[model samples]
Target: KLDMRRTLSEAINIQVPYNFERVMYLLSGGQNQTEAMLKMEQTQVITLSKDLHAKLQDWVSTYRVEDSEMLGTVQNLWGCHKYLSDPHTAVGVNAAQKFLHGTQRPCGAVICLATAHACKFEDAIRKALGSKFWDGTVLNDPKLMPPTAGSLQKLPEISRGTFREGEDWTQRLREVIEGRYPEATLVTPHLGTLWFSNQAMAMLLGITTAVCFAAILSKFARRSKR
Candidate 1:
């Protein structure tokens, strides 16, 4: 049920789906013994049932978009809103626009999630916005090229290990981990505190909605009066 194409959407749109078994195989460092041991502990594959799958199909409507459309979306957003969006986010926005304009248009606001920073996908950005603009403006712009990008690029490799076909990868990984940290440390997880109370949040949401509604009503009233 997946389409595999050579597009800007590299992360999600894949040829073969990496299932739980494939993940375990990777985590085991390609060691058959380690993979078997991991499988013994957790072997259950969670797949949606027929009814649930049917219900999901009924609820969700997926739109297929071309690379050209995604690029156009990215360019348009940048030109109009001064917002430089990544290819994946562009895909979502393009899809959302298609859905809104299509025959079965939904009422609610479609929030296209901007998952990653534009700096992360430099090649894609360069393609969307011409190389001339990218080199001249985007390269010098602090907002586009953040300090963290340079910092990340300058980061040294903490640990390195090779997993050869005929070698014991588990032992190799063990050696690497031990070399990095001789003694294992137990760190307690910190829980995040909520900023807003339930009542306060409800009141804020109500106010925002009321303001939006009032604006819409005012716009319509003016149109009718005209």
Candidate 2:
């Protein structure tokens, strides 16, 4: 059985991707010879040069956020800004807020990049906010959900392909990709059409145009100030 404690900290309710832990173990010279680590030994690994590593250590400041803190951040952002944030974005925001209040605070705006739509992390959002909040804002309100979200939820059939341990999983994956798996069934597109419609294209074009216009206006405003 896999050790949950290695990938997830039960005390803080914090979970990290398996590959992340693997890389860290390799870099830190951890000695446990796991199957994953043995396989990684065959592949070429890149390391940062001493000078670049020193420069990064000098410039970058990282802060840790617990699951509870991330959840609190999600709640606070929603309450204060009326903005829904996924847990991943909330973690970054929480860390950014901490840095701002810390001794080495910067004198500029701190932009936290949102990784995904709030709907993608429904469980995290539901946990952060209550069921009542989720019902009111998401379940009952159709307008609150993104257009692509509805379509995604309505997908007719989904399948998972599994490979056993000690098997050549990579070769099996290659066979699947090459359409050699007799049991594998290909899914035809629903409605016999592509997912991206002309409306979506138009909306994307409009957003791009608006961003370009805003950039030009900002440049002019800066020049005027000068």
Q: How many clashes in each structure?
A: 0, 0
RMSD of each: 19.5, 14.5
Q: lDDT tens digits, residues 1-226, model 2? A: 2233311112233232346434444544553324343354444333554754565455456788877888899999989998888888888899899988887664356788988677766677888998788767775556557777866766765333444457674565456555565322322322122232334434444676799999799667755654
lDDT of 1 by residue, 1-226 (tens): 3334577766665443435344544444443333333344454324444754565465456788898999999999999999989889999999999988887664456788998877777778888898987778776787887877756556553322333456663454445444543322212222112222234434545676799999799667655654
C-alpha lDDT of all candidate models, in order: 0.64, 0.61
Most TM-score-accurate candidate: 1
Runs with alpha carbons beyond 4 Å of true place in candidate 1: 1-3, 15-54, 107-109, 153-167, 174-226
RMSD of 2: 14.5
Q: Please give the lDDT score at residue 30 for candidate 1.
A: 48
Error of 2 at 223 (Å): 48
Backbone clash pairs in model 2 (N, Cα, C under 3 Å; residues 3+ apart or in different chains), count: 0
TM-scores of the models, in the order given? 0.54, 0.51
